[model samples]
Structure formats: structure tokens, C-alpha cells
Target: MSKAAVETISGESLSRIVGAVVGLAGFATAVLAGMTTTNPGSVTLGRALICLVAGVLVGRLLGWGGEIAVKEYLERYRKDHPEPEPPAALVRLKQKRDRHEQIVEEMKKSA
Candidate 1:
């Protein structure tokens, strides 16, 4: 194994990058809101944390929306350009196997 090779993102990871980005945006908004709402003498730490969490949640949802949209589009595109059907001989073999399975199941139940 070469330890020096550069790693590249796969198509799936590339797709989910949208989600990660959205999460970051959410986190930022949360932190900002938290920072703004605390009193002058109070510890803003709690507020900051609460907002940070909220931000992350928001970002995740946004990212998910994007990912889902992409996935749907890809699925639609693939459906329109499907792979070729399997050979008739292969289909026949599958049908025979299914029939054999049902017979085995019926015999087991009777026994």
C-alpha cells in the first residue's frame, strides 16, 4: 500500500458536500444569535453553546434538503436511461430457482 498517494472524494461524498456546507452555515447563525442575546455581565458561554448546537441542526437540515434534491434528480435521470435487460436464459434460470424455492418451502411446511 502506498501511503503517499493523494486521496480524492468519491461521487457520493462529493454529493454530500452540500449537506456539510449547510451544516456550517447553521452553526454560524446559531453562534451569532447566542452571542447577541446574553446580558453584559452574564457568561455568554451557555448561550454560545446553545446557539452553536442549533446552528448545526439547521445546517444539517439544509444540507439534507440539497442532497435529497440531487438524489431525486439522479434517480429520475437513471430511470430514463436504464441498463439493458438480462439475457432470456438467465431470466429462465431465475424463474426455475424461484419455483424450486416455493416447492421446498411447501414440503418443509407439510413435514
Candidate 2:
């Protein structure tokens, strides 16, 4: 499979797994909290809110963790197999073209 395809699949699978884990953990916490509380209604509402917040926070953490993992993996790969340096002239020309395009885009947007 292509690199792009592999990356996309890995990202989606990671997200799903993270989501499931967060959801399960949240549910378990809520249930435990509910069991320990005296007021059923208040406890249930509070537990639900806690679960929602926990799931969001956990998901965000997982996303950052995945990004870090990918960065580390790429760094290791680069270390193992170094790439040849591109011509300096060609790199400068590409940068100039990019800058020109950006200016043109800004002009068009302001028009």
C-alpha cells in the first residue's frame, strides 16, 4: 500500500481505539461514582458531565500522543536512511515561486 493510504488508515484506527478506550473508562468512572453517592439524580447528572469532560480530555491527549509517536517514528526512519540533499539553486527558486504565489493570493483576497 501507498504511504498516504497507510498513514490514513493508521490515523483512523488510532482514533477509533482511543475513542473506545476513553468511552469505556468514562462509563466505568460514572458508574462507580453513582454507586457511592447518596442522591441518585444529582450524582447521575454529575457523573454524566464528568464522563463527557473526561472523554474529550482523553481524546485530545490521545491525539497528541499519536502525533508524537509519528514524529518519533519518522525521525528514526530518517536516521536509518538519510536522504540526498536537494540543489540549493532549485530550493531557492521554489521558495521564490511560493512567495510570489502567496503575494498574488493576498492581492486577490483584498480586491
Candidate 3:
């Protein structure tokens, strides 16, 4: 298949990208907020790590769910609608093939 026809962002990849972005954002925010507190280094670090993990999980789940919902809706829509006709080129190709077959059969009968 052509590169353009290939799926660029699948459900899994989208989930991973969203998870990484959210995880980084949450980690950065937690660290910056923790910096202003009187909490010990270990506690601040712990909170930041927790936020990172939570953010990643939540973001990934949301992304995956959203992808599934969109695909389901599209599938339902497709089922409810009629498929389009074949392209003009394809129709022409089939007609040419039929003509070729007919000529071959006629030549065979004459021989």
C-alpha cells in the first residue's frame, strides 16, 4: 500500500503520545509547586512521581477510549450508508479485459 494510505496515528500510538505529553506536564507542574513548599526533597519527589504516573494512565485511557468511540461511530455510519461506485478507471479496465477475452475466444473458434 502507498505510504499515504497507511494509518499514521493508531489507537496505541495516540495513547502513547498523549500519555507522554500529560506525564511530562504533570511532572513539571508538581516539581515546580513542590519547589515552593517546605517539604523534604524525598516527599516532593514522591508527589511528582505519583502525578506523572497518574497523568500518564489517565491520558492513555482517555485517548484509547476516544479512538475506539470514533471508530465505532464511523463503522455504524458506513453500515447505514451505501458504498460508492467504482472509479471510472476501474470500470474502463474491466471493460477492456472483457473485450480482450471475447477477441481471444473468437480467434480460438476460428483456428
Clashes of 3: 0
User: Best-fitting candidate, measured by lDDT?
Assistant: 3
TM-score attained by model 3: 0.60
lDDT of 3 at 44: 91
C-alpha local distance difference test of each model: 0.62, 0.72, 0.81
- Model 2, 43-77: lDDT tens digits are 78677777967886787578557856776788789
Identify the superior model by lDDT, candidate 1 or candidate 2.
2
Which residue segments of model 1 deviate by more than 4 Å?
1-42, 57-61
Q: Give a tens-digit lDDT track for model 1, residues 29-102.
A: 65566567755423455554555566556655656665666667767888898889999999999999999999
| C-alpha TM-scores of all predictions | 0.45, 0.45, 0.60
User: Rank by lDDT, descending?
Assistant: 3, 2, 1
Question: Which of candidates 1 and 2 is the stronger one according to TM-score?
Answer: 2
lDDT of 2 at 84: 80
